[model samples]
Target chain A: MERTGAAAIIIGNEVLTAKVKDENGPHLIQRLRELGIPLRSVETILDDVDAIVDAVARARRRARYVFTSGGIGPTHDDVTVRAVALALGRSVVRLPEMVSALHARAGDTPVTAEGLRLADAPEGAVLLAQPGMWFPVLTVDDIYLLPGVPQLFRLQLETVLARLSGTPVHLVSLFFTLGESALAAVLDRVALDMPHVAIGSYPVFDASLDYRVKVTVEAQERSQVDEAVGRLLGALPTDSLVRRE
Target chain B: MERTGAAAIIIGNEVLTAKVKDENGPHLIQRLRELGIPLRSVETILDDVDAIVDAVARARRRARYVFTSGGIGPTHDDVTVRAVALALGRSVVRLPEMVSALHARAGDTPVTAEGLRLADAPEGAVLLAQPGMWFPVLTVDDIYLLPGVPQLFRLQLETVLARLSGTPVHLVSLFFTLGESALAAVLDRVALDMPHVAIGSYPVFDASLDYRVKVTVEAQERSQVDEAVGRLLGALPTDSLVRRE
Candidate 1:
């Protein structure tokens, strides 16, 4: 299948172990949505080479773009670069540009051997100049290896997203007084008939809310979304629909 | 490999589309940590059957318990039950217990066919009686099928968690004034020496914080954690060490 959307892999042991609540995954999801780039999945895994390799390879197979958060530091746990290289069947190589950049940043101070780990990347890697940051974005093919630091992740993400293009989906939501069980058939029929249109049914449990369920119809074109919504509204009882947006 | 921990699959189109920030994944991670169960991974995928099946099968292979959130309702989008059944190579069957419970809940009113869809589950599924709720926790093998609604998910999760057991990890944190580049070598040595202990190095960019990096040492035994911490503290520069916790 042709890859279209983006996929994210959050290599965060701190997040999986609950030491830190993951800000990157949610932030990436929100930013990707705002950019109108459809996201296929967001996987949170440990900072292990095998797991990272598997996740990266799987993401590449399904998504046009793969964004990885965390595991991009000098520490031993920072194995995303190596794992990603293995996933792409490439050897890890020290990028001369990154080495030069590190030396420039260090100035007169001698860069430690461990510090030079920051310069290592997949054999064929490109660096995108980042504004206001010493380290540039590390990218190979369509995969972007981002630092786990929330601040750094945000800044680098902005730089990467600026270069990509997306088509924003047209969406309409219908609020219903009836529950999913009451509205399932009509939704099933409309969703089945308009396979291109993406339909979502979300049940709301809050008694304070006026609606019981919220049905969303979305597609690349406004006409498809509108047509699907119209079909759903027509098939369902008029009294059931509280409002449509 | 012996499956000892838990893995989660958050089947959420709304989450992937950024219509809703996923509360369930974070909540599950926190709860699992509190319960002393190590979490292997948490994958958030769109509410699609192929995606759900792939994720479920993968989780089962790596974890003793697999928890899936969302796509458990009556609508066309609610395909978790069918998908999970396919993942396990089982046929979907309506549970008599759930059907009876639904009938009892409906009382004088006739239950819709869509409403009875809630009774469907993978063959040989068991329902754990959920206290203070009409629905019980649905389980086939070690997979727990949970609702996407935050409130319902929380309540059901508690019921399921209470039935399982876990061993809390022994953990210690060390604060350093030095960055990861300065600490990588020492950490690498300690981590390589003791494979049992999980060592994590997190760099704090906030200048307001007293420490530049926070290192976590953890294992099943307190002595192991303490030993790892001691090795780390001994190897790093005395002036770089800020504190320990």
Candidate 2:
């Protein structure tokens, strides 16, 4: 079966302003890759309604699954749910199950109006229940609304990953001491020859690092990735090959 | 002076696949903020031509300046320049000055066709030369094409930043032990009252962290930020205020 394409939308003003370093995008990228979902793009947008709506709509059109991080809390800045609802032409309604979960989590503390807002989701959205989860994961159509908090986002993503499967990509990396310019021609030739595989060359400038050029060969098929890596290694000058791992 | 909006397109397959952690986005975000240019969005896209072209077109339409990092090298995956040129209805051309610089850097080594390809830039693109720079930074219209290498990208960005300036934003942060839900109502009231100041509340869940809710007040004017912070402190419960910084 063909692997499904995925895209992510990271919504927050703090992230766009450099006030907060985004941990969600990196985390999702790693996790989604592990789950075999090929993430096509990640867009870090502001907390504005129009931006969120536009990003979500575009991401939905581009990929099979859209994961959104942040802007789902009770705070005024949290507008992901409203934006997604507006974008999909759906109304935001309070989910009774989520309200009960929020009340239970509060224990003796009264659930304030702001806290109850956490229960709101797009109309006809599904609540994903998981073991030991305080709040149920909310999904509207193909978009998954995840908490901005890194821990919560990871927890909810793991549950989502459990239900989804795709063709696992195989990657083979070859490191070289030569600069990318020196290997560019060979890489281009190999890329042209093997259109089935994705070949990438990255120049690492860190003096402390061992390699200068890190070439990666990737494909859904392990044999194709391995063959491409072999060809890349053979094409490189023997002296320039640092290590193949 | 009004702060100009900026957007970034991070073009690379390595970043999207989690094979490489992106250093450019955060680096640019902080640098752009310090330069008083507010970054509106950052889209990490694949090395595909259509993706790069589409992202660049969208970013150009959205912001005053559009910055693209990566896909400027000589390798096959380096398609950013071509994409930008096609998107803007221009053609790519080899830059003689860049070729000379590359030859100089190579010293005794012969400049290969691949190495010379680095000299290619979008039609009518200006090469911004800076002191002690080996390569001139490429700029087409308001779009800056930067390298993927972290050190080189930083160097190029510094040169670009020196030529640009805008109204710097002032930020005041207040920490509280109370959850965001507890402060939501007060935050909404403060946000409504202070239209100029951008108020944001972030919930930090780490037990090791001293504060739960981090409220940020930002504005172009320092006085407005200060005033909003004062009003926010006054509205919050005394016991909930963990620390104000």
Candidate 3:
């Protein structure tokens, strides 16, 4: 119930319209899991300002950290910065550091007024310099503004995750030969009894699969997970369980 | 500005926890696009009751049709019916048709009390008999509660989409050698002038790609899209133009 995990908001119209597939959401899910951080949610919405604001505000209320992908570029659809600022009730201010960086990068060519829009960010924003890249990860009040591009998103995500810590959850999986209908009662009992341990029941419809239902019991403490798995094993039909890991 | 698009709520802890990759969201997006229906958003949230309620409420306010995936089963985690009911300000009730179908399918073996939970639905629910399947598609209002299983989700989606109508959007993709920052001014001008047409600019970071940015111009009318594309081509530098489709 405590808001400890991270939440993601992927801002892209191309993905919703089927012009492009979203690779950032899945990648973020995998990375967050690998880092032992539990993810609260992933919302893929259009590149609209109000939608981004709503998503970011909701995500902030339910999570300690919020990460938004895309809509940070210097174009018409790039409204993430403005939206995130609105959500945080902050003014969009041009970062002098970013302006200097852009000027330095441009060198001989003058940075256009539109191109200088990249220097803008929510007030009190912090920039985490990314190695081997010019654009730093723009962040404010635990909300990370990540690029929509897959490669950049992955890189910026690593930069953000390095600063956070989480407890790794210990899990035990039990696969059964019987279906969910036969296993629901027992699972309900264990799940209800062990509030600390998270129990998940998934049924496989494919006949080719060896197991019919996959039950997962997980907890921050290994002992709790093991105890719940033991109780499940004891209550379930011995012959019905195909394997446990 | 009107609520005309479809929105999706993917209720699954497995997806958020990285236990399983979500295939249903992408499949739904692709199918909705093929059906010429605009997708408002796709939110992947936990199986928590309050989470489902909040997402459903927000989705209903934004889109005409809402599709929810997962959490429809005979287990404790299967709380979609209860959550959706609360969202719609309705009560959960047992569907007599579902009860009869369960009885016919079970035959000689009696169904468990927990198994009978599958017969429960939100008030004023309708069951669309799925072709070649024993179970039917559970729907209420414009919300379709689909199974989590990939195959079942795909099949049920087709059945739901068949009943809906949409106008196919006319799209024109233009690839350019110039980056977003270089083309932002022209794009902003055309995008502001042609409010009916939607224009998107995306930058490519990879050097392997031939183009620096891919610009998308789309509208329900082909003439609007073509006019926007022509305006963009005319405004942009002739040498910087790559190709258009």
Candidate 4:
């Protein structure tokens, strides 16, 4: 089975400057994993138009779905929409519906020229609308434009995920007190035996925690993952295995 | 003055799967900022050789320096060295000095075949040796290969930073109770007036916190940043300004 490929572009200078830690990349990673789309790559780039355009174009070529977070706000730094449009050779135009929505939402407050920029997107882009959402999500070609705010990004992602479907991967994880080196040989053997399964070994070195390595087995077939996990468990020393509920 | 550009490649499947939250990207970002190099891009790619090569080559073209974290370990997944070599059109070769170091460090512990893989690097790569460090940091061309462990990556980065230099950027930030929309016009005006300084406005929506917006000003000179900050402070509504030490 061919796995669907996905890539994410996290656009913000705050994230790159380390002033604001990114909550979007990790959130999107988990969501893509749960959706069974193999997130091939994630680029956290500065709020530069050239960089944004290059990242989006590269991601578009590499993956079936591309998600971008940040730079959609009404500010000097917000340029993702225009960048995406330029990258895809499309022109950015203001949507009348979004302008009217902003007008309706702004009642007592006056909408500035910058505020109206939020209504603009790549030509032919689709706006995703849902009840109670203050703003609609924008989709241009295969790229999904999402807000930088963690709360809004998560909410919009859920709505986006509902419209997309993918094959779910079966995964099994086993924790071991033994170091990664101790399990390397057995993992290599198991991996060679099961070419279809993807095996990963992650070491967690915490003085407070007893677990040293977390070995994960993933495959399209549940039986393949289970078989690899069973073999891995049998190969490891019983004393090193960490049993958890 | 032109700013020196830097980019990072975070190589691992664990990170892409969300099984591991990346500590490397944030750590590197902070370090690069302190070192005064303008980090342009950060790519978190899987442990695939092609992906690693593509990311490294792209970063190398865009930035003066490229730092890659992870995939240098002694395992099936550790392919950073080879991938980087391929990307740079070089061949991977085992370094006798590294092998000797590994042997010396192993003492009573037997060095497995996988463990010996740590001795390999790109043909033209230079290993950075320092006092008190168990293993030397690898540098092929401009790409610095760092370990995934936060502690190790930080240590290696400090050593790496000592050899490099960049013009420092001065920054000043102010918090305000006023929302982003309320301050947008003033910020636009300030940005227009101070072309050399970069102004950014970030909104924080927390019911518990009084501060709604955090405006940051950055420039090559401290005076320029301070000038922009002064103008911004004077332009905002006095009642909405949040005083901070």
* DockQ scores for all predicted structures: 0.91, 0.75, 0.90, 0.54
Model 3 over residues B1-245: C-alpha lDDT tens digits?
58788999999899998999999999999999987899999999999999999999999999999999999999999999999999999999999989998889999988989889999999999999899788999999899999999999999988888899988889999999988888999999999999989999989998988899999999999999989998999998898878878
TM-score of each: 0.99, 0.93, 0.99, 0.90
Residues A1-245, model 2: lDDT tens digits = 23258999999689888888999999999988887889999999989999899998888878889999999999889999999999899999998888888888999999899999999999989988866667878897878999888889989988888877877788888889998788998899989999999998888778899888888888999999888888887877788888877
lDDT of 4 by residue, B1-245 (tens): 13258899999798898778899998888888887888888899998898999999888888889999998877777889999999999999999999999889889898888778889999988999865678899998888999887878888998899999888888788888977767888888999888999888888757698798788889999899888888887887778888642
Local error of candidate 1 at residue A169 (angstroms): 1.1
Residue A21 in candidate 2, Cα distance off native in Å: 1.3
In model 2, residue pairs whose N, Cα or C atoms come closer than 3 Å (at least 3 residues apart or on different chains), thus clashing, are none
Candidate 2's displacement at residue A127, Å, is 0.8
lDDT of each: 0.94, 0.88, 0.93, 0.86
Docking class of 2: medium
How many clashes show up in model 4?
A: 0
Rounded to one decimal, what is candidate 4's iRMSD?
2.3
Give stretches of model 1 more than 4 Å off.
Answer: none
Model 2 residue B130 CA deviation (Å) reads 3.9
Writing each residue's lDDT as its tens digit, candidate 4 over A1-245 gives 13258899999898888778899999999888888888989999988899899999888888888999998888878889999999999999999999999889999888888788878999999998854577998998878999898888988998889988888898778888977767788998998889999988777657687798778889989999888888888887788888631
Superposed on the true chain A, the predicted chain A of model 3 yields a TM-score of 0.98
